[model samples]
Target: MTRRAKRTRPATPQDEHAIPLQQQVNVPVLNLEWIKSRLNPATLERLMQVWGLVGRLTFPPSSSGKAREGSRRIPTADAHLLRKAGIIEEASSTITGGWIIPFSVVEEKTNGLRRRWIAWPRDKNRDDPYKANAPLLHISHYLPPAMAEAASCLDLKASFFRVSLPRETRHLFRCRVEDGTLVELTRHPVGYKAGPEILQIIITSAIAGVTTVVHRLWAAPPSVRIDVWIGNIRIAGSKSDATLWEAQVLRNADSCHATIGRTANRAPRSTPSWGCSLVTHTGRYP
Candidate 1:
């Protein structure tokens, strides 16, 4: 009598780059309240200004590059996140954006793919002598002496995390998915040439805003300076008995997470959260 052979499941390959069937370890299961709150119109307009969205700005022009047609291939996992977040949507004939530049979806590897957006390159309008300036911005790489104490550096994901954009600029961001469908971007993109410069300005301004708030709330210790260096915001300061600035900074950052984006302040915080509070929410979000 022949014994029945045991059946085993097929093994799945571990190729991270494989587009199909790849899974993300962390998908932010759509917090409706959070999403709705962030999408408020008043918040969107202010966020645009804080993000340096103004009269004239475009992706860097490619000196050695030519404009590619359609969208580049996107990893399945990364594309899913975009759709879920409402970042990318199908274009309609009435979509009144100015241009339809193609974009690439980027990836963030973990237990699986995270996210990145395809970007970088150029364009020109009539009569404007195009200047192909180098895509370089000053990055402040600062860290206090550490004081050998309990100083912490919060890695804020300020760059390319999605924010509001003018509807007219819709012509500037477009993507063609694998199924031959054209898509449009509803939010600001990551991996663009201007990301670092814009973020540096915003985060630095956030630091200043926090500074002003902290100063007003408390009296002594005028040295309560917190710096968000490295083009990303960080809660920089000392925790010695001489001051409680670190604690105050963290508290203020968490508080500012929402109100900052809504207030009329020139340094409008795009997202309700920034700096340390965002670090704490890493597990809660993606």
Candidate 2:
């Protein structure tokens, strides 16, 4: 049973500090709802007795990015986790003139076998308003430990389409698939302006959940972190810890078909950050 009152004193010598996270707690995917249920001020006051990082963990529920700029400095990892519960800005343009964006499915013939060639609609929304934005880690978020060696990549296949769309917005994503027939999207469309931000919400939740388990695992202290991008996630750490992190991610979400492959640990050759401003040119696929 959970205690209601806060613990006023420190853990006595008899307390088992060595107890592992797996043995202590199991947290599911964390979002605003999940955090509100237990991590609010009232509950956190009581939990401070248990976890004891209440001050660092506290953040404004609906605080915007601008609001956070003036607040006390929060550790990078914890700040990223707390952001999952904060209000996010929507980058999707307001629909006007009721016309669906035009699309075509012409896959290019280059690199036929190696790259994924899903039938993604070529969207013409470049001229349309797109405001998708998020707080992202620059490629050099931190320096790697010298002992930390290789890196690996995990691709969340067709990430945008995997997210289910609400009934009301489905019509806004209607597309023509080469044939004369029109199809309404039941899931988030790949080329849509709001798609990346929507996917970021869920991925952030998953990261918060997975990181809790990873940090408590025996292998965690010299931590091995798995960083995420729009669809591609990279797990970089010491060579020995790769399997440990991979296994935990798969266990966290069995349905996600995460493909593992060798990857360069260095930053991207193009501007060294994940936030890209260049609009995607029309391209063909399946």
lDDT of each: 0.39, 0.33
Cα distance off (Å), candidate 1, residue 114: 5.3
The list of candidate 1 runs beyond 4 A from truth reads 1-78, 92-115, 121-140, 147-150, 207-221, 234-244, 255-286
Return the top candidate by TM-score.
1
Task: Tell how far residue 124 is off in model 1, in angstroms.
Answer: 8.1
Residue pairs clashing, model 1: 61-122, 99-171, 100-171, 104-118, 106-116, 106-117, 108-114, 108-115, 257-272
Best by lDDT: 1
Clash-forming residue pairs, model 2 = 91-131, 91-132, 106-284, 106-285, 107-284, 107-285
* TM-score of model number 2: 0.42
lDDT of 2: 0.33
Query: Once model 1 is optimally superposed onto the true structure by TM-score, how far is the C-alpha of residue 244 displaced, in angstroms?
Result: 4.1
Write candidate 1's Cα lDDT for 1-286 as tens digits. 1111133222223332443332222222222233223233543344344344322434443454433343454445555666666666766664322333433332433233322343332332322243322234343445433332233344443334434545665555666656666666665555444445444433333433333322233322444334545333434233452235545434433433422221212221222233332212112211
